[model samples]
Target: MSRKLLLKAVEQAYSDRRRLVAPLLGFPGINLTNSSIKVAQQNYIEHYKVLNALYNEFHPDAMFTLMDLSVEANALGCYTLFPQEESATVLHSSFDESRLEFMNSIEIEGDSRALSYCATVKKMSENFQDSMTCAYITGPYTLAGLILGANKAAEMTLTNPELLDDVCGTAYEKIKTYAEMLTSSGAKAVCVLEPSAVMLGPEQFIRFSAEYVKRITEIYSESDIAFIYHICGNSMHLLEAMCDAGVNALSLDSPETGMDIKKACKSAGDNIIVIGNINPAGKILYGTDDEVFNETEKLLNETAEFPNFVLSTGCDLPQAVPLENIRAFMDAGRKYKLP
Candidate 1:
């Protein structure tokens, strides 16, 4: 399909206030492999299959592939291994300051692990190009957690400010590079998954996370692809900072109140799009399809007239979430009409 047609499809969906579906339909506990560095090579194909399957089954307007978070960290020499039936985990925690220091020299495209992510994104774009809104994940501060150790990194934000800059800066550059690659490969938008950003106080979030995100946003501002910042925790305080970071949209967790988010957005002059606050774990995952639809209806009503709003869960849908609930989400989107 032509680029114009692809863009038009996405635009029409947004203009009609249609909720675009993402590949995050599976639950968090679902298995993600990390057997070897070489396994990274196959990450794209494996994830693509899941996405393809989901697309075939549901036929959503858009889709995304789940790449292991440790992809970049693994390439940077961090020891990470995947366990059977469990998500990828970092086996070792020691940050080689030397590696972090030389991060600027690292080439994101050629790095073994980073390349795998890029390849997976490319394959998704190639296969689902015109039909789906392709997406890639860059778990921002969470990536920092893998490299610096979450506790130590949080401490450094307070105790060693300079080092924190280096860490975030390095991670930001890598994420920016990866984001560019994904867009070039045909992603309509890239979601920066910054789940750990919520762990910091507002002050710390501003100091440590905002600028890094800003740098990336600035780089992609003119591109056709949109940028969304996903924070899977209470993000009330950092809402403005996230907006300032140049994100085109925000994805909030179910724990966050939609009223609070709307208020914050209003205060920020409604600068960015708001995607979600559905309780995926409690309501969508465990609840029945009717229950899911009811919850979705509540959100749709509450967010009415809020341009650029998209219905979604607080975070990625868990693997164990009832597929019926997933269908309910899509069904609601299709059935919804503005009054």
Candidate 2:
């Protein structure tokens, strides 16, 4: 599809009388298929099974691929761990500038895991025409954090800003290339996950994370590919920078993490979509069906007045989250009427 048709799909979804329900599901959905996260991450057929399972059961307005922050780092030679049933995790490595030549020389699209995700995106576009297809990319600062250990990345911020800036420049280029791969593979909506940037104050966040994010979104400025920016923890102070980053939407954390979703939506105003606020680890994971329904309905009552809001979990649900709980969340969202 051309970019205009993709933009039309999203616009029609948003304009519908009902609010769109799209949970940031990845591993939890894999449980429906006879597959593990490790297998799905490595094999495209297995990944499409997960996507099919989620769409068959929950029928979200949009479908997001498995959320893995390790793709770019793993492609660039960072040490990564792949648990049998969990998403891959990148280990902290000491930043050594001498290694930049080798890392920069490596082509990320050649990576097996990166290729698996691209194939999954292409499959989603081909197989699932009714639902919007979305994917995730590691944010520049987060990728830089993986390149340099988190503590070192933060220390270099004030101690050696020049070196840190250079590292982030490398990260920005890598992320841009990966973005091109995903977009070319047929991902209509791509999210830049910047979980590691939550620790920095607003000023540091804009300089280290948001600015590069702006540049990444510029690649599709004329097309409505739905660039979404997501941070893992509370980002109350960084809402200004987040809204100014030129993304079409913001996936915020749960109120339990000290993020007031109502306030976040107000800050986003009418232009940007607010995709979340439900605690991934809260009621939906531990409470009864009634509890999850009440929680979902309560959030809708509070924030559905904003036409741009989409009902979703704050972050990806854990693999252990019971399937019945997800049904409860979806049931609540589907039953509610938009204000």
lDDT tens digits by residue: candidate 1, 75-167: 666787766544566764666678776766878778765565567667766776445555655565777777888888878877887887778
Cα-lDDT of candidate 2: 0.86
TM per model? 0.86, 0.95
Each model's lDDT comes to 0.67, 0.86
On TM-score, the leading prediction is 2
lDDT of 2 at 73: 93
| Residue-level lDDT tens digits of model 2 in 1-339 | 234343354346557756678888878877898799988988888998998898888888789999999999999999999898778889986667887778878888788888889999999988787778899999988998999988898988899978888888888888888889888999888989999899999989999999999998877888758788999989889999999998888999999999988888899987778889799999988999889999999998998667668889999999888889899999998888765
Weakest ten-residue segment in model 1 by summed lDDT: 28-37
- Relative to the true structure, candidate 2 has a C-alpha RMSD (angstroms) of 1.9
Model 2, TM vs. native? 0.95
